[model samples]
Target: MAAGTATTAPTPEPAGRRLLRGKSWLATVPLLLFFLIGFGLPAVAIVTGAFTVSSDAETGAGSFTTANVTDSVQGAYWTALLSSIKLSALTALIGTAVGVPIAQAVLTSRFRMLREAVLTASGVLANFGGLPLAFAFVATLGNAGELTKLFHLTDHGWSLYSFTGLTVAYLYFLVPLMVLTITPALEGLRVQWREAAQNNRATGLQYWRHVALPILFPSLLGGFVLLFGSAFAAYATAAAMVGATVPLISRQIADALSGNVLVGQGNLALALSLDMIIVAVLVMAVYLPLQRRSARWLS
Candidate 1:
């Protein structure tokens, strides 16, 4: 059409490059299979079972029903779920408050040994929970525990099996978890930002309030979401420590599965599990967006 006009043609991809790209997907085959077998199948089963009821108890034949889900949200089950949410929220908040300062301290420390030591301890402790953690607290704070007897804490109406005590137990690991989570975000803060604030006649508190906190807010909230999920799903520690005394969703699920309180309530267990899955999905929905924002700033 035009004598002087130059048109660019797209380069064709080589056959070998196309073949290599096809082969690259093969590497993910194992992981895909593992996920399907491990998570996907179980998730499908839970959802399906939550909506089914037995047509014949002996033969285990089932029919679709919404009764399981409806039952899961009433009476004791509802109370247990609320208790779990409250406990998780409380521990997550306290853990975040405690952890941020400790993380900042570890990040600002001049001594490498101290930093390494704290980090190593945090790594170990954050992964420490369940029966052993329960026993540890019971031994240290129970009615007849050493410190309890020594300080006569029981006389002051302190009980290790109560909500307050469970909170203390949760904070043990949750705080360390927060420290591990928020440390990298703390490290992402540049010295230049602090210097700029100083050059502007900003005090340390002013710098943190305006510059650092704004930047770290996403990470902090993400860390809170993590702690909330951890505490929410925790079963073993609460089961071992408080038993039926403190009604928890996890405990209720366990009881439903084991038929401890009723016979043939397996579908109810699945329903409870579905509730947990919904909560976890909501938590991820919040966490993922915050993580993306934090990565943009920190990375």
Candidate 2:
């Protein structure tokens, strides 16, 4: 332990490993840049605008304020938020219930073409929302439309503009979205597990109750969160379908941003967007742990 004793130099990591790390980062550059430009900028704009006030009379720089955020949390906007939540939750539930069985059927199908067709259709339908979707439903179910007129359902007090009808219209896309989300989870139910259960003399019900459901539960819950967020943030579909009749948060955001055109209403819209971003963050917070748990079974 003499002061003059020579100390050993630490060994460096292997060249290949360091190069691998560098390459990994290099590979991610495009995606990282896209994330920075696409999502990051809008997020920054939303947060800053949510807190922004008018340009300073002296310096011409935006002043900071929380007034817009405060208003976003108050009466009408709050009500719209509640409406969005209720509608999103209900539709997500319905979509999951309906989509799960369809996914299961497709997953277990013997015919590959049938499965492929259904899956292809599902992919298309999941993305088939917004104004065009609204118009499609209107043309099909409106009072003067083919089925409605032929069946005379309008005389029986059926209205496509009601909350129930809006929920139904939402299902047009949502069910497919759920199917897309859950299909892979259903497929991830390994046949080995089923055969193993059978070897143990387990019934179909017993196997699902004890094993299958446990594995699938986390995935299912994650899908529900995704579905909820998607519906919560939906704008164009609700706007085109019911306009302001449904009082959704997205509708209010649009109104604040474009329709109202009041001074600083853009800030209010940005605050509403921040609220949505918060909800999405909360959803991911819950989903992350559940997804990690799911990986234990899936991996």
Candidate 3:
């Protein structure tokens, strides 16, 4: 350095900015702890337990083995898993198809109260499932139900305990969930885009096909993935309604845990849980990118 030249010190960060940064990080501590305790630890335990077999039931000691995971993908377990996947996919597809139009209608409606009512109802209904929902359906559609007797539906071969009935029950909640999910995306559609299409001599159908649908596709697909995960993980409703008759993976997991048919099968339950986690991870893998894409357009 030249002797005549003077050096300057770097400017320090403002105390308020430093405090804000510290507070922001402090706010995340509870959330981080929640994920660590509620998800991370349980996930680790499930993975470890899935790969080990109990050598002594009394002591809960186990040795490492891959048989639990191998068995989870075979026979009854595999069948149950497939059934779950099919059910979830079917419900999600139907829910999306039915929901998108309803959401659009709700969005375009002139009445503020109507929109508020539907959205509020949807928020409640989307979270409404499990035993109460099952019971309500059973009372309304069961063999001895009033509707069944009045319309002779049972004689016409409609059974609430069947797979078809389960699909119907799933839709009751899924459709509302889809509505709640896709309404914002529908609302995000700028009027200028439609006007621009109209200025180019495009019909409504052509405009939707060329522009609107493409823009909304990510939100639509993300909603489908969300509904699929919801249906896939649902257990209480299926358990209450159809019990073991449906052979769903959730039911299978419960059976394994309880040793309903097999003794000392807790490890098998962990394997099934791991399977569920993998499916959830895959669903999230697909959902997150779609969500990011949707946010780019919508936001």
Candidate 4:
């Protein structure tokens, strides 16, 4: 060997990398097309509709205007916005409270059979949504439901059509999502920290407060944002449970499009535009904090 340059043969591309690069374009083509068709075109149309209204007799041609937003902001739009925020906040808090404990149990338990059962049950529960899930709960918990009729619980006059019932349905979805998001973080926690704390005679609560909480705060908060987003966007569960009794923002928006809640095409478009704006703002607010926290973790 003449020098360091001559000491070894040059490295070659790994089989995995070569195969991936060679076939990646094939996979990307379908995905790119899907994104363009499914997301890009609809988004452009919504933006256009949000800015304009149909022309009246005074106007010769269809016109563009900003009044769609201004008009909505002045009307029931504000009420819907406030209601959505309140519901999302409540759902996020309740979901996080229930989910954190379930996630902790799932991640920390050394029982393999129990862990597998939890994973399987969670997977099934995660997909339980829409009207069917609502009716399932209704049939079991409602006044006419089996549980009610079988035990004469109907005398108690329980109903799954109240705001409280809607909250329960929302939690049914929210808790699973939180568990899914937090479990990975829980598992990723290094065992040594807990062991060290235990060796030092730290109580369970102290270990959680002083050792685990700081490490998991970012993930927990991110999971909270996810739960809030789910609750905010959900329509089916709310509609099935509350009907027209509770005027949730989503149900209202759906009614607008079908001319059942608010009248006029312009109003429907305006409501949808308002909803889009609210979602955009909420997503930005949640994601920015989450990103900053993640950056701090990396640092």
Candidate 5:
């Protein structure tokens, strides 16, 4: 019998492609480490701190109790929770209003130069949070601020320590995030889709309603949820804007820790517990809808 030629099965992928696939694990390592260090540690600390009660002045015991959580849920706690929900909802609404237009303007336009500038500004503005950022706004619009003085609106016209002022400061951050999130969704609107809609004689509003809005709504809602959650927990910015006029959850938490509250360090534990509960609920509420929307968009 003649010898049969040897046969070999083809490789699943080329060697070069396999090499890149194998290296994908490297990309995931940093993200895993980040979640472990940044998120994991703080979560553990908070849980431990909240449950374990204090014994001596500065020390806490290993035991657990529900008293802290119960005590922290009354009076000022209830008020702060309501204020947080209201403020966050308002911020999300405002962010959506301002961001949608800016995103639409940028994505639909052919101005490359302007797009870069707008994107850069959006990145900076989106990250403008915390105390320093708050102070920057204060310096520009506060009673003694430069622009306030120049515009002659500081003395008898406007007050920056009011809820309205806090809303504005929150908007400064929320708008940028909305722009960043929604711009991508807008850009993803395959040109063919728009052209096809136009070819069918659809008006701008009609096109948006039937095509654009559905596509962009997921991103818009996701961005709004993120900004809402951030605004809810926002400590430094609102604190600077309201000072003593408006009481926010973060400020109360601070008070608990720094002796501003009469309950001493117990209040700190209680406040932390409240913070944990509020954050957990907010996260779940926002995440569920966002996750659903994201899955819908993907499918």
Candidate 6:
């Protein structure tokens, strides 16, 4: 009300509010420390070890170089990396193909309980991977197993240890994961769009081909890449089912890190881990944009 003075903004915020803000930030300290200990430290070790020479005399601070990285991707390791990529790409595509329809059906269902049941099942099956899943598959389809005996699979010649078999096993979990992810995206597909297409004399197939598929494409592709990363990083099931015969990069990384091999194995393993990290980063980079776009509709 003073002529020459201007009103203050209530001291911006009270001391108590400032203190609460500090406390809120302070609450994250434990989580930050946990991340530093659990992830940060390991990441540092991997990065350093990837570039650090194995036999340096400095002990604590070894000589740094990129020699390990170059060696990590050569010879057998290169083959393994390619193999892993192939396996992941194939399985992810297959999973998307299998999962999209199921998700769409769930999204379009009239019954809420049926939708809930399917989603609940998908969630359970998605996490039902690893060694246990492999073992179950083997028990049902392995040589002299129940299915092998009942269906006389030996006469039909279905070997469960091969690449095709591993793919089938991977599909068991991957499909359900796709179902869960794509369901939300499918739900984002508006009935209005379909009705509009129908109003314009478009058939269901034409609607999907022209409008629905285009809208859903980015989300579908992103899900495929997510599945790829999931399958790429998986170890326990692949290790249990196919072992070293599969020529997977994850298995090789484990072998290098297991301390059972050459002196430079640690550096090799770290380099491999760094490569995997880079790949996952690239995948996520593509995914983030598509995610933002897809989220626009859902939001």
TM-score of 1: 0.92
Error of 4 at 276 (Å): 3.8
- Top lDDT prediction, candidate number: 1
Candidate 1, residue 290: lDDT:
73
Q: For residues 34-81, write the lDDT of model 4, one tens digit per residue.
A: 999997787777777767777764663556877766755555765766
lDDT of 3 at 148: 86
**Per-residue lDDT over 249-269 for candidate 2, one digit per residue giving the tens place of the 0 to 100 score:** 888888887857465477789
After superposition, which runs of candidate 5 have C-alpha atoms over 4 Å from their true positions? Answer: 1-8, 11-30, 56-59, 144-157, 266-299
* Candidate 2: segments with Cα more than 4 A from true spot: 1-23, 55-60, 259-261
In model 1, where do residues sit more than 4 Å from their true spots?
1-18
Worst 10 residues of 6 by lDDT: 53-62
TM-score of 4: 0.80
> If both were scored by lDDT, which would come out higher, candidate 1 or candidate 4?
1
**lDDT of every model, 2 decimals:** 0.94, 0.87, 0.93, 0.75, 0.76, 0.88
Q: Predict model 1's lDDT versus the native.
A: 0.94
Candidate 1 C-alpha error for residue 50, in Å: 0.5
Give the CA lDDT, 0 to 100, for residue 157 in model 5: 62
TM-score of each candidate structure, all chains considered together: 0.92, 0.89, 0.92, 0.80, 0.81, 0.86
Query: In candidate 4, what residue range of length 10 has the lowest lDDT sum?
Result: 262-271
Candidate 6 Cα outliers beyond 4 Å, as residue runs: 1-38, 56-61
**Model 5 whole-model lDDT (C-alpha atoms):** 0.76
Per-residue error at 194 for model 4, in Å? 1.8
Candidate 4, superposed: residue stretches over 4 Å from native:
1-29, 56-61, 146-159, 199-201, 261-263, 270-274, 288-299
Better of 2 and 4 by lDDT: 2
Q: lDDT tens string, model 1, 213-293?
A: 988988999999999999999999999999989889999999999999998899999999999999889877887887788
lDDT of 1 at 179: 97
